[model samples]
Target: MKLLIVNPNISTSVTELIEAEARRSASPGTALTLRTAPFGVAYIETRAEAAIGAYATLVELAEHHAGHDAAVIAAFGDPGLAAAREMLPIPVVGLTESALMSAAQLGGRIGIVAISRRIRAWYRETVDACGMHSRLASIRCLDEPLADIGSVQRDKGEQLVALCRAAVREDGADVLIIAGAPLAGLARQVAERIPVPIVDGVSCAVRQAELLAGLAPRRASEGSYAAPPTKACQGLPPALARLVGREGHDNENEEGNS
Candidate 1:
């Protein structure tokens, strides 16, 4: 199966981070493609950035391959996930929701550590939308800047482990999720230090994408996702456009094979 992973932020580094984690966890036969915003939308540290990033993601999805077997919106906030699902017939999986659900299956209760203060509401909305709010222990933010988390010497892994400990001890959480697509590589490091299972949204989303694509006997309606949007899209990277068109064609071939 083929999956398109969309990182809402414009940071190519963040995109690479998520793609690497997805590759590590993906089933051997599954094919994965990664895409990101062409313009720089830093931090996604606030509600305003999340809103704009959502629109940008939708535009990218429209211009590119909605026809993949499934799509993973690789953002903890899941910025435009709902809108993407509504716009395309294909299943859209949110990293945050997928991670939390995975955590739920591992334990009775789970806690989330968001990337920033402004995203607390987004975290709550993700839990509520996934019907896992009752299982959520708490949502905490580092209150640190995104730049700091990305720094080499910042030791985000250790800090996240400490936060997870607080969630488990003070908040009574049995499972923990180190949220955000940008922090995809930090889970293993944190899990090693923390007693409970630590979930990474990127890995969770990839596995969920694999499951959803496998469960569906057939792909989405060709008229809906197989065809690219007729409306003009601006500022889309050439490479992304090619990837979308290629995936759409591959979907047609898959249909023909069946």
Candidate 2:
């Protein structure tokens, strides 16, 4: 199976982090392709950025490789998830939704440890959309910048684990989710220290993507994602154009028709 994991941001570092986690989580025999938007707002720290990230995600999907069997949006906010699902025939899985679903299945109530306060609404909206709001205990913000989570020296790792424990004990959460791609590696570390299961969105997303793609027997339906736009896209990466089959003039024509 070929799965495309998309990080809807300009940061290649964030994309690499998600790709590494997906590779670790994906089942054997599965091919994981990681891609990121060539032009998008960085950090995605505010609500505006998250909203823009949604559109950026669609742009990424529109230009996705034609050979991929499935797509995973590697964002905790789950930006452009519904739109992408509607635009693509193959399975489109969102990290936040998949992680929350898995977390809910593990326990009666789940708590989400979000990356920033601005994304609390995104978390709430995800639960509401999934009809799991009743099962959601609380959404806690780490109150840290997104970039800080990726720093090895920031001590955010230890702080995140402590927050997870508090959510389980004080927030009455039976399950916890570390809800960000940058914080992907923290879940297993936190889970070891906490009593409740700690879910990582990246791992959960990859697993769900594998399961959904595996269940589908039709390989012909693969790679039917929205075609790339026709207009000239500045700074469009060469790798992206090669994967999607069109660049420059041809790309604009496809996008115009799509």
Candidate 3:
């Protein structure tokens, strides 16, 4: 199986972090391709940054999705997940959604930890979209500044573990998800310290992408996930515009139109 992971942030260092975790998590025969967004913020921690990241994710996917069996939007907020899934035939999973689902299955209440408090609201929206908000115990994030976007996992590992423990104790959380693109692989590094299961967004996302690739579910032709109507798109990359316009419509759809 082939998996493509697109980090919507412009930081290649964070994508490398995600690659390390995905390499450790994916199946033996699975090949992983990781891409960094050509344009966007260095880190996506707020709703506005995530909104830009969403467009970046789509552009990355549009240009490079060929030959991949499945794809992952490797940002915690899952910036363009549904839109990507609707626009592409391959299964597209989101980092936070996969981690949250994996954590929910492990225990009842879910706790999420990120590097910044600004992301709390957006991550909350993700939980609600996944229908896991009711099961959420808390969303913990640090309010202070950090040295680097790519080094938070190493710089703040202990701080993150403490937050996890507090979530379990103070917030009554039964399971935890370590979210954000920079913290992609931190869960494994700190899992032993935390009492409950600590889910890694990168790990769960790769496995979920692999599972969906193996299932090879047919693309929806008539539902909400169905290929959307072809329409005019302006000021976008050519490849993305083609996809937006459904320029490569299959014979069946063309025949129907005829």
Candidate 4:
């Protein structure tokens, strides 16, 4: 199966991190194509950056989704995930929700570890959106600013381990989820140190994407997820405009696809 993994942030280093983890986890037959956002913040730590990520994600998929069976938005926050699902016919997976769901299967209470405190509220909102809020044990983060966005895992490894341990000790988290794109592969690196099962967002997302695409589920026809009606989507990119106008389709397969 062919998959497209889009890193919503503009940082190529973070994109490389995601790509490495994905390569380590993906099956041999699974063809992978990864892309970094041409627009948006270097990394998404705030709600405003996340919004730009959402827009960039939509534009990326709209232009490059052809021939790909599934897509994974590499950011832990999953910006543009829902909109992509609504707009495109292919199954799209987000890192945060994938990690949360994987943690749920591993144990009872889920603990989330991120690099920044600024992301706590937004990550909480994501948990709530995924309906995993009730199962959340706690969220732990390091408040100090980082010198670089690319090497966060290498720089904060010890602190992150401590945070994970505290979540297990203080918050009673039976499972831990290492959140954020930069820390994509940390779970495997430090799994022995943590007592509970730890989930890596990128790994779980890639597996889930394969599972969904393997099923080959049809696009939504009715309900909120069904495609929007064609309208004059002016000033959008050419590919997006064509989708919005339902060009080359017989009766608007994109009424739910667009």
Candidate 5:
């Protein structure tokens, strides 16, 4: 199975971080391709960055997702995930959604340790939309300024273990999900220290992408997710206009973009 993993942020190093973790977790015969956004912020901590990141994600998907079995958006925020599902026929998985669901399966209550406090509200909204608010124990932050993927990986294990311990002990969480792309490998580092199950979204997302690649492609419903009506725009780029005017998915390529 072939999968495309899109990192919405513009950092190539972060893209490598995601790819490494994904490779470690991917099942046999699963081929993964990585794409870093050519446009957007270096990291998505605020709603404004997520907004631009989301647009870059869509454009990345359009340019790189032509022949992949499934697509995984590597960002925990899952920018453009819903829109990608609507635009493309293949199954779409987001890191945040995959982590939450995997965390749900491991235990009852779920706790999220995010990279920044700024993301708390947006992450909460996402969980609520996924209908897993009842299962959420709490969302906590590391209480530090967000750093690049490389910098965060340097000393994040200490803070991660501390937060995971608190979530399990105080927050009444049965499972803990380490949120954010930069916090990818911290789960394995702290898994032995924490009693409860700790999930890394990158690993969960890769495994889910492999599973979805083997299943029958899900068709978009005729209502809200249906293809946009053909229309002409006055000032948008020609590619953007063509994408807007494009009709429904082919639905014939069950094996992906091939």
Candidate 6:
């Protein structure tokens, strides 16, 4: 089965990290295609950045989404997840949603360790949307500066271990989820030290993506996610029109010309 992992941020390094973790976690016979958005900031920390990343994600998907059995959004914020799912026929899974679902299935309260404080509210909203807010113990933030802001002082592995322990001891958390693509491999790094199951969003999302890819695609009924209305999109780029499936365009001609 073919799987596409989309990292919405512009950072190719983070995408590589996610690709490695995905390969390790994915089942046999799963072919993974990892792509980082060529536009947007290195990281999506705020709502504005998330919005930009989401647009970049859609652009990337439009360019390379064909033939993929399933797609995984690698950011913990899950930018453009619903829109992507609506646009694509196959399953499109988000890292944050997958990790929370996995944590909930593993039983008991869920603890989230995020890279920054700005993402806490967004994560909380996501947890609430999943109706797992009642199972949430707490969302803790690591007080480390971004690489662009300053030298990162705290070792990610150590911080993950300590924060996970604190979540268990102080917040009464039963399962811990390290929340972001940057924290991808830290789960395995501190897995032996942490008592409970430490869920990495990247790995969890890839596993779920593989599972969803193997299943029959969802049937979009007449009312539910119905076909988009046919109309000409004026005052837009030709590529954008083709990307969104706008009317009055010859796809074969466009592809052949390109």
Q: Largest lDDT belongs to which candidate? A: 4
**Poorest stretch of ten by lDDT in candidate 5:** 246-255
lDDT (Cα, tens digit) per residue for candidate 4, span 42-126: 8888889999999888888888888888999999889988888877778999999999988899999999999999999989998
Give each model's clash number. 0, 6, 0, 2, 1, 0
Stretches of candidate 2 off by over 4 Å are: 144-149, 152-154, 217-258
Tens digit of lDDT per residue, candidate 1, span 1-258?
A: 889888889878788888889999999988888889765485476667888888778777766654577888888878888667645545679888899879988999898876677878867876788899899899876766555434522446566667789998999889888888768867865566888888899999899988987887454446454534434445655534433443364544354335
Please write out the lDDT profile of model 3 over residues 65-138, one tens digit for every residue: 87788999999989999998877868899998899888878999998988998878888988899998899999
Tens-digit lDDT track for model 6 on 109-200?
99999888888888888788778899999999877567641122134556767888999999999999988887777787778898888899
What value does the lDDT take at residue 65 in candidate 2? 42
CA deviation > 4 Å runs, candidate 3 = 251-258
lDDT of candidate 1 vs native?
0.75
Residues 1-258 of candidate 5: C-alpha lDDT, one tens digit per residue: 889999999988888888888988988778888999888888888778888888888777776776787899999879888888876667789999999999989999999998778889889988887899999999988777755555686766677678788888999999999998877777877788899999999999988888887876556557887655566556644444444553332433333444
**Worst lDDT 10-window in candidate 1:** 238-247
What's the ranking of the predictions by lDDT, best on top? 4, 3, 5, 6, 1, 2
Ten residues in sequence with the least summed lDDT for candidate 6 = 249-258
Off by over 4 Å in 5: 234-241, 247-258
Show the colliding residue pairs in model 2.
Answer: 229-255, 230-251, 230-252, 230-253, 230-255, 231-252
Backbone clashes in model 1, listed as residue pairs: none
Q: By the lDDT metric, which is better: model 3 or model 4?
A: 4
Q: Give the least accurate 10-residue stretch of model 4, judged by summed lDDT.
A: 249-258
Clashes of 5: 1
lDDT of each candidate versus the true structure: 0.75, 0.74, 0.87, 0.89, 0.81, 0.79
